[model samples]
Target chain A: MIRIKVRPFFQLKEILKEKELTIELTPDSTVLDAIEELTKRLSPSFKDAVIDKNSGKVRSYYRVLLGGRDLHQLDDLNTKLCDGDIISFFPPVAGGNRAT
Target chain B: MSGWAGRILLVDLSSGKIEVEVLSPDLKLKYLGGRGINSRLLYEGIKAGIDPLGPENLLIFGTGPLSGTLAPASRFTVTAKSPLTGILGDANCGGGFSAELKWAGYDHIVFKGAASKPVYLWIFDDQVEIRDASHLWGKTVPETEIMLKQELGDSEIQFAAIGPAGENQVGLACIIGSNYRGAARTGMGAVMGAKKLKAIAVRGTKGVKVEKPKEFFLLIEELCEKIRNSPIYPRLSVYGTPGLTTLLNERGYCSVRNLQQSGGFEEIDKIDHEALMPFFVKSKSCVGCIIHCGHFFEIKEGPYAGEKGGGIEFGAIGPFGTHCGISYAPAIFKMANLCNQYGVDVLGFSTILGFAMEWYQRGIITLDDLDGIPLEWGNYEAAIKIFYKMVKREGFGGLLGEGAVRAAAKIGRGAENYITHSKGLEWGHADIRAFKGYALNQATATRGADHLRGIPGGELLGIPPEEAQKKFGTAEAALPTSYNKARMVLHYQNLCTLADALEICKFNTEIIGQGIGIEEMGRLLETATGVAMSKETLLEVAERIYNVERAFLVREGIRRKDDAVMGKQGQEAVASGPFKGERLDPDKFNQMLDEYYQLRGWDKKTGIPTRKTLEELGLNDIAAELDNL
Candidate 1:
C-alpha cells in the first residue's frame, strides 16, 4: 500500500471538508484511482467538484497537480503515484476554460 | 438600427456646445460598437503630439448594440489618449451606468476640449444639460453619487464620477461608475479631471429594440444556460475574482514583494476569498449579468469596522496583500475601499506601492525621501497613510502619484532598475517571468502592461496537449514555458477584442471560454442587429479593432523597442516557487513576438501593421496615414 496526500483548494476544499487529507491506496495507483478513493472516502460531491460527470474524467477547467507539476504536464490521470506523493485539486477561477 | 440607439452625442465642453449626429451604418458594420467604435473615433479625433491632458484630447463613452438588451454582462468602454501613457488609452467597466447610457438613445458620447469651470453632463432621454458642478467637486465616489441622486431627485439615476484623486489629476486616477465599478486603468479619470468634468449622470425610459426579438431572446437563453453550466460559474459567483489568489499563488504566478519572490507569501491563505467570506453581505450583479460575481462586504468588527463596498476583484487584494507583504485581510479590504472612495486605480496604486517599498528596501529611496513614512513592506498603516496622501497628491505621495516611471526619472538614482513595466505603465501584479505567453501579452498590450489585454489561461488551466493542438495549432501553446505562445496570444487578443467590442463581460468570453465562443457571439450580434454576420466575419471585425488600436499606438510613436517587458521581468529569474529560477529567455521571447507579429500580418521588424494588412482590413485611410508617416 502507498500513502498519498490530497490537498483541495477553494471550493474543492470546502466540498471535501478538509484542507488536506492522507489516504492509502494500492501501489502504483494512478491519479484517477486516488480520486476514486477520495470520492468514496469523502463525499460524492468531491467527484462533482473535480470530475466531469459526463466524461468520467477530471474536468478540464479544474486543475489537478502531482507534487508541484500539472497533471497534464506530467502524465495526467494515468500518472502513477508513490507513497508520500502530494496531489492538489483546485477549482476553476476567473481564468479561461479548458476543453472537456 | 434596431439593436442600436442610433445616435452619437458630441459635446465640446470648452464652448458648451452639444450636437446630436446620426449613427453611420458603415461605421457600425465595421467597428461593431463599444471599444471598437471608440478606438476608431479616438484615432480620428486626436492629433499626433497633442498633450493628453490638453484641450485637444477627446474623451469618448461608448456602449455596444447588445449593451441595453438581454446580453449577459453588458458593459461600456471609456477611451482617450492616456495622460498616463500618452498612447491609446481605454478601460472597460461593468455596472448599471452602461445600460442607463444605452437606454438614453445613444451609442456614443464624445467630449472634447476643457470646460472653463467645474461641470457635469446630465443626460435624460432627449434632454441633455451641462450643469455647474462646483458643489460636487472634491467629493468621493459614493459622495458624488449621493449628491447627484439627491439633486436629480431620481434614485435610479446612474452616475460616472471621479473623486479627489482625479480632481487632483493624479496619474493613478480612474473613473468610478455607480460608486462601485471603475474604469480603472490608463488614468481615464485624470483625463476627465483635466477637462474639469466632474461627473456624468444618465437616465432613460425608452427600452432597447431588437430586430428579431424572439431570436435574440432565444440566443440569450442559450448563452445564459451555457454560462450557468460552465465550471467557472459557481466558484466565480461565490468568491468573485479573489478566489484566484490561492491557485495563482500555488502556481508561482502571483508576485510577492514586488516580484522579489514569486508566490512565496506564507500568509497567502489569510487574504484568499475564504478569508473574506465572514465579512460578505450579499452577491452583487451588474445589469443583465447572470454570474453576479461581485459581493458587498463590511468589516464589522475591526478597525475598518464601517468599511464596505463592492467590485473588489483579484487586482485589489492580490496586489495589496501579497505583493505588498500585507497579510492582514482587513487592511487589504480597507485599502480597496479607500481606492474606490477616492476613484484611484488599485492596480496602479499597488504597483507603485510595491515598487516604492522595494526601492526603499534597496536603499535607492530614503525614509526622508518617503517623508518619514517608514515605507516598509507589510506596513499597512503606512501604506494606508501614503494612499491617502497619494489621492490628495501631498508630501512624498506627490512624487508617487506621478506614476512609477516618472517618479523613477525624478529620483534618478538608478531607481529605474527596480521597476517592472511596459510602455511607461507598471505591470499588473503577476509574475510573467515564468509564463512566456503572458510575458508576450504584457509586453505587447497596446494599453501598457495589462493582463486583461490578452490573458493566456491555457498554460495555467492544464489543457491537454491534444486539445491545445486542436485549438491553438500547437501543443507547445499549452505549456507556459514554451515559445509557441504567439498563436494562443493572438487568438486570445482577438477574443478579448470581440468581448470588448460587443460590450459583453469577459467572464462570458475570454475569461471563461466555455460560456460564449465566436459562433455564439456572431449569432447574438446577427439576431440583435439583423446584420448578417458569421464567425469568420466576427473574427475579422475583432482583428480589425485590434489593428486599429495598434495603429493608434504606432501613430503615438510605439515601435518594437517600446513593446517589451522591462526591469526584473526582463533581467532576473523568479526567486522562489514551483517555477523558481525561471526567467524569460530573450531569444524565445523575441521568437514568440516575431511569430505574433507574423500571425497578425504586422511588420515583424517595426511591429507595425503593413500597408497591405491595413488596406485588406478596410483601413485604407489609416494605411495611407502610416505610409505618410
Candidate 2:
C-alpha cells in the first residue's frame, strides 16, 4: 500500500479538526480512492463538505490538488496517486468576498 | 434616462462654483455609469502632460443605475489621473456611500480645479454646499466621519474622507468611505488632497426609478438566490477573503518576505484565515449584498486588545503578514486598522515596506537612512514607525512615499531591480509567477498591475473542464499555467468592465465562478433602464469602455513596453514551495500579449488601438485624434 499525506485548508481545516493527516491507500489508487479513504476515516461532515449530498460527486468549487497541481490540470479525480504524495484539499477561494 | 439620475454635479473649487450638467442619454448608453463613464470623462477632461496631483486633474465620483437599488453589492468608482502611476487611474469601492451618492439624485460628482482653502462638499438631496473644512484637516478617516456627522447633526450622513496621509499628499494615499471602505489604489486621495477637499458628506432620501420594477426585483431575487446557493458561499460568508491566505501558501502562489521565497512562511498556520476566526465579531456586508463576505473583528485579548475594525481582506494580511514576514495576526490586524484610519493603501504601503526590508538586508540602505530604526524582517514596530513617517513625509519615509518605482529610481543603487511594478504601480498580494493568466492580465491592464481588471478567476477557482471548455473555448483556459488564456482574460476583462459599469459587485458574476453572467446582466440592464441592450450590444459597450480607457493610455504615450511586470519578481523562479522553480516565461508572455492585442483589435507591435477599431466602436472623434498622434 502507498501512503499519501492529506491536508485540509480554510473551512475544510475547521471541518476536519485536523491540520494534516496520512492516509493509506493501494499502490494503484487514484485520487478518488484516496478521497473515499478520507471519507471512511474522517467525519461524515467532511465528506459532505467535499462532495455534494445530492450528486454524490465532489463539489465543483472544492479543489483537491496534488503537489500544487490542480486536479483539472492533471486528471480530474482519476489521476493515480504515488507513495508519499502530498494531497491538499482547499475550500473555494473565489466567488464570494469583495475583491480587495 | 430611466435608470440614470440624469444629472452630473460639477464642482470648480477654484471659483467655488457648483454647476449641474444634464448627463447626456447617449453618453449613458455608451458608457453605462460608474467607472465606465468616469474614465470617459477623465479621458476628455484631462489633457496630456498635466500634473496628476495638480489642480488640472479631475476627481470624479460615480455610481451606476443599479446603485441604491436592491441589486447585490452595488458599488462606486473614483477616477483621476494617478499621481503614482501617471496614467489612467481609478479604484472601485464598496460600502453605503455609493448608494447614498446615487440616492442624492446625481449619478456623478466631478471635481475640477482646486480650492484655495480646505473645504468639504455637503450634498443633502440637491442642496449642495462647499463648507470650510479647516478644522477637519489632519484627522483620521473615522474621526472625520464622526466629526462630520456631529457637525451636520445627522448621524445618517455617509461620508468619504481622507486622513493625514492624503492631507500630506502621499503618493499611495487612498480615500476612505462609509467607515472602512476604501477607494484605495493609484493615489486618488492625493488628487483630492491637492484639491484641498477634505470630505464629502451625502444624505439622500430620493428614490431611484426603474423601468420595470417587478421584473428587476424578480431578477435580483434570482441572482441573490444563486449567490446564496453557490458552494463557496458558506465558507466565504464566514472567513471572507482571508481564506485565500492558506490556499495561496499551499499552492506556492503566496508572496512571502517580499517574494524572496514563495510559500516560504513557516508560520502559515499562525496567520491563515482560521487564525483570524477567533477574533471575528460577526459577518458584515455592503448595501443590499446577500453573501455578506465581510468580517467585522475585534482583538479582545492580545497585544492589540480593544482594537476593532472591518474590511480587512487579503490585501492587508498578504502584504503585512506574509510579505513582511510577520506571523502575528493581531499585528497584521492593527496594521490593517492603521491603514484604514490613515487613508493608506495597504498593498502599496506594505510593498514598499517589504522593499525597504530587502534593501536593509542587502546593505543598500543603512541605519542613518532609516533614521536609526532597525529595518528588519518581521519587525512590525519598525513597519508601523516607517508608515507614520511616510504619511508625514518625514526623513527617508518621505523618499519612499514617492512610491516603489519612483523611490527606487531616486535611491539609484540598482534598487529598481528589487521591487515589482507595472507602469509604476505596485502589484497586489498575489505572486503572478505561478499563474500565466494573471501575469498577462497584470501586463495588459490599463491601470497598471491590477488583478481586478482581469485575472481569470474561473481558473483560480477550479471550474470543471467541460464548463471551462464551454465558456473559454478550451479546457486549457481553466489551467493556471496554460499560455492559451488570452481569450479567458479578454472574456473576464469585458465582464469586469460590465460589472463596473453596471455598478454591481463582480463577486455576483461569472468572473468569480457563479451568480449572473452577461446574458442576465443584459436583461437586468434592459429591465431597469428601459434600454434595449442584448448581451451582444452590452459586450460592445464593454469593449467600447475598455477601448476608451486604452485610448487614454495610448494618448499618454503608453505602448507595449510600458505594460510590463518588471524586476526580479517577474524574472526569477519562485525559491520554494509546491510550485517551486516557476517563473514567468517571457516568450509565452509575449505570445499571450500578441494574442490578447489581436483579440482586442489593436496593433500587436505597439499595443495601440487601430483607427479602424476605434471608429467601428463609434469613437470616430477619438479615432481622428489618435490619427494625429
Docking outcome class, model 1 = acceptable
TM-score of each: 0.95, 0.96
lDDT of 1 by residue, A4-84 (tens): 988788656766678789999999899989988988987777677777779666777778877666876766778999999
Tens-digit lDDT track of model 1 for B314-387? 89888898888989988888888888999999899998898899989999989888888998999999999899
> For residue B544, what is the lDDT in candidate 1?
91
How big an interface RMSD has model 2? Answer: 6.2
DockQ-based class of model 2 = acceptable
TM-score of chain B of each: 0.99, 0.98
Best by TM-score: 2
| Ten residues in sequence with the least summed lDDT for candidate 2 chain B | B427-436
TM-score of 1: 0.95
